[model samples]
Target: MDPDGDPARRVRGHGLGLVVAPVLRDYVVVDIETVPLVGTGPEQDIREIGACRVEVAPDGRHLVAERPFHRLVRSEMVSSVWGSGLSSPSAAAVDVADPDAGLITCQAALEGLAEFCAGRPVVAHNGRLHDFVVLDAACRRHGVPALHDDRLDSLDLAHIAAPRIGIELRPNADGSMPPASRSLDDLAAWFDVADPRRERHRAVPDAELTVLLIERMLKTIAGSEPVRQLQRQILQTGRNPWARFLEPPPADGSLLDCLEADTARMADSSGLSSDPTSRIGRRAVHEAGIHARAAVRLDEASVLAPLSPGGALVTGEGRAFRAQQREMAAAVLVALADGSQRESRSSTSSAGRLAVEAPTGTGKTLAYLVPAVACAQARRRPVVVATHSKVLQDQLLTDIETYRKSIGDIRCVLLKGIANYVSVGYLDAAIEAGPEGPIEALALAIMAGWATQTATGDWDDLSISQIEAAFPPVRELRTRLSVDELREFATDQADRLCFYRCALDGISTADIVVANHAVLVTLDRVVEEASHVIIDEGHNLEDGATSALTETAGSVALTALLDCVAHAVSGAGVLRRYAAACGASPPHERVDEAHDALVQCRRALTELGSHVVDYVRGRTEVTVAEAASFGVSYRLRPGLDTGRAEFARARRAARALADHLRRLSGCLALEPPMSALGTRHWRHIESELGGAAFWSAAERAGRGVAPRPRRCLQAAVCVPRASVVEPSEAGVGRYRDIGRGCR
Candidate 1:
């Protein structure tokens, strides 16, 4: 056993006493150690080196018994340790006789390890730290990159294996938070694996012992079917490994308050109160929720089983949408079922893709949900319903809750980004900092309080316009909030704004996901990566995509900017009115330039509108492209030639605005990061929304197609044959239950 050998020899002896258990079928356990030389600094030679390798088989696990590689070199120069005290200690107490010798020996040991563990994934306890350092140092010494290959960490494995087992290597015996280093034997004993008991702390035997411990733990945590079920749930939610991780909170946190506050501030700042009846903001939010719910139901309906020849006999008064919803739901059901069958036949199936053009008020949410649930029940796949607006997401949740009561054992989860959930730690930080910290934090606190008061994060729960009265001014004072605070806020907000498509893409583990059209557009961009997509609100798809693809610098917007500039430059009271109307700061340079442009544009528009009215009154048919060109030339071009004087000034202002716009567009555009989350390419949509001529031009540009005449067409031609509006127009009763006298 070489009793009176060198310290490296002693460590090798100690390592040999350790036994390693195997985790994988063909597992190779490895350990590496490096020592820095004195005076040599970071660019020094290794003072000592040691390593070990072992393997396991079904018959029995055995350590490959070639003499464990050991080397030692005397340092030519004195050097301090590279890692912190948290790192492992060296093999010996005294300096080596020669550092070069140690490097040579270490090189030999590493060479042996490479040969031993060839064609195997390296297993190490905290492999990134210990093995990485040793290998990197060795590679540097050898004039070649250290071994580069797939490696697994036993520490991570341990966390996966025995989650409750809390083992800390540092602090030594006192457990008073001291040196943060690990010993191989200590870990083996702690984890109840074979102890090599080698007096010397070399690599090979230590690696063997680690392998043994990991193997035992793997067996201990092996599948029991029950464990697998638990694992699936954990995997699905991607939550904490401990206890029922899939469960959500009773309510969404603080979002309603923040939203309410934001909306009120927006209204106040923009002078929305003057009209009082202009419920655009309120209605936008509410209708978003209502439509989202309808969309989901519509999606559900598109998958349901079709009605018989007799159809569903009309019973109740409010059941107007039932028959149509059932028909739509049946269509979706056929899609899902056929899609599933097709997938069984091939690897991909488009059967689950259903595009329904149901109108807004037709109870589409139930329609979608019914068939979605049916498909889910049949195939055990989730029903994911997504909408474009947050308000609609809230409405879907309400519908889910309502449905849950009516239908038993229906599980639904409304997922937002991680930011939506309020963090206790952040709240504590804010509360500890007192009221002087960030206004955002303070606003967040108020929002948190409101969350507690309300049952859901629905803004409608709060009285309209009370948010500003309740929380008033958001603190403008500068505060150095910690990254933790910022992160908490960011994460919470992300949750609120997270696109449903992203959630679906991320966690395919769910049974149902609800989202909007933007998300569907995003899905289409990455359609190959997703499974079984159905887009509700089929009528809105083109328009929504068009809106996404287009941009408008309208007269109203240009006027607003000019108003701000006028306020800034001329100190006019009208400027203040502009600010009040637009909810923005007075513009300085860019605003002035924009104002000038807007003036020219308004004059041009006056002329163009007159021309258009004249043309419309004079003729029965008009081409959109011709009109758009006329409008653009007359309205937008004059401002262009009045250029170059303010061009530099505009450019200077524009550069900053452009940067801001780029960032905002990047954030909002359905492209890249945003597109993956449900933002469709807005540029394409924008091109379409530039009126009839633009759309005509775009189509012609793409396929050499000509534009259709833009005449005052009947709404009946545009409406689909399946549309209820179409049937009702023919003197058919449009009541909820259209049972008899229809045909």
Candidate 2:
């Protein structure tokens, strides 16, 4: 049994290949350090390489009995690339005096690593983005074929297994913060893995630390068998075990299908059995219902009595709650659960709305959450908590877990927009397309592990940007899909349920749904589900709404639109894949025609964007000052006429581009015989068409071809604190606020 032979086998249940644990007991851990120099001409110089062989016992014990392979690579090749002298630090780190005499050459080091990793899974922390890439680059530079090993990123595994720790970003010299480091040293310290090394940057020590971290994480995951069982159940059943708590019940069987498909894919990959069972049993369900019922039975007098002035307040933990928090909770509970205070549905203020402001240390989240949960349980109506930031959402999720333990089993879920999740069908397609490079291969591996372990398909739990940086295609495949279409492609109930869970489908059924304000405004289903809404950081509402309503036809948008057309034309996207599967070819001539129109439109948009930027710069007399909310801003140049001609030209160009998009959408609509698989792609294309229509309408309105109603543009631009000066009496007013930034 070759553990690394089949990828499907490796990424099955718990992402640990539990079915083939015995065969996967032996593997090598590898790490590499590189000095990246300026210039793209082969400047990656490998300073060191490290490798360790380990064996695991069936009891989950592991040993690194073999002597580790550690080597310092010669840096003479690096000197050639950098022109003469190497950096002092680089020179000191290597045997530069007689570089090749004692040290291994890059080619030799890579070959050694390949031999060591051969027929065994190779593990490293962030190997996909850093170590593995560096090693592959070195191999390419030395004319060696890349190493073919079953690679597992311990970093990816750690995120799935260990407790999530907040990444603290390091402030730059300019007061901006650099992306936080998830380095081996930092993670080891986080996991409390001892490393007594005097210096931490060395390849060998880091590799050893990575192995230790992996062992620790594996042990922790193994110990949590019940959670794993629950996850497996979710996969097999295509239903969240706690879904029974949902009001009206989640009617969509599609969610279960989607979740089960994902589970089945994972199981098939790892040769694990995908057989469903009554393993969860009636006892677990009975206990959960009991807990939920008990949680909702709070005596109004008993709960509200302590919250009165001069009365001691207590939490579910028996600790004395803060007075301010208690008071706030009392007010919220009265508004929500108090029948006497509950207004008639037809009343102007019938909806329960309570605004509370307390200092930071007052435990505002818990204060509102306790009452909200109690109210929701009592009324059997879901509560939606709208947050302005991901930080608050995470904090709320943590607090919700605490409440669940102390109070009762409340089904709370975090809801984000579709863009945050990777589509299972798309991901599977991308992997099957056979990633052409090492980075892409690594991305596939990482995603495989993540798919099996992730409860919510949201990329928030993974290092998404890092993965995308390693392989750009991963980002490309993250296209949003409609819930109904996702269900169609979902192979089983598990896949369907997973999709529903992540895409905010059936979210209304949750006891408490935590969502961002952006989701509230854009995803109508979210707002429609809740009987009451709690907006945390309520003061940001105006700004959030402003952002939600704003639109900008900027360079980024144009480029992305062009890319979409290009993908469509080349028959290289999800739609094309589905079309192929259906034995259908899209109307190639029509697509080509649309593609040509988009190309011309893109050129025009580019020109228009530049003209708009120049017009803004020329009209503003004052120096362009950077505004925190509005980016760069300046007052109109004194005595300067508003650039009416420029505005008209830009508007014309935008309208033309929108027309081109609409034409392309029409072409896609004429698609040949499509199967159910093609439905998702068709829907996405339709969405794109809808966007084009919106832009066209907006452009027409801005150009005054459509009704201008209140002439709100002029009012907005003339405001005293407006970022840009008022438009002149000329028609420039119509196009002055052309590109409003939106969330």
lDDT of 2 by residue, 371-468 (tens): 78777766666788999876677677777756654554566666765556555554443433333333443444445444544455555655556556
> Where does model 1 exceed 4 Å of error?
1-317, 320-322, 339-353, 359-362, 415-429, 437-444, 450-464, 469-472, 475-509, 522-530, 542-743
TM-score of every candidate relative to the true structure: 0.31, 0.59
Best by TM-score: 2
After the best TM-score superposition of candidate 2, give how far the Cα of residue 191 lies from its true spot, in angstroms.
12
Question: Candidate 2, overall lDDT?
Answer: 0.51
lDDT of 2 at 363: 67
lDDT of 1 by residue, 191-220 (tens): 555345564455555665676676565443
Stretch of 10 with least lDDT, candidate 2: 275-284
Model 1 residue 453 lDDT? 29
Q: How far is candidate 1 from the true structure (C-alpha RMSD, Å)?
A: 29.6
lDDT measured at residue 436 in model 1 versus the true structure, 0 to 100: 28
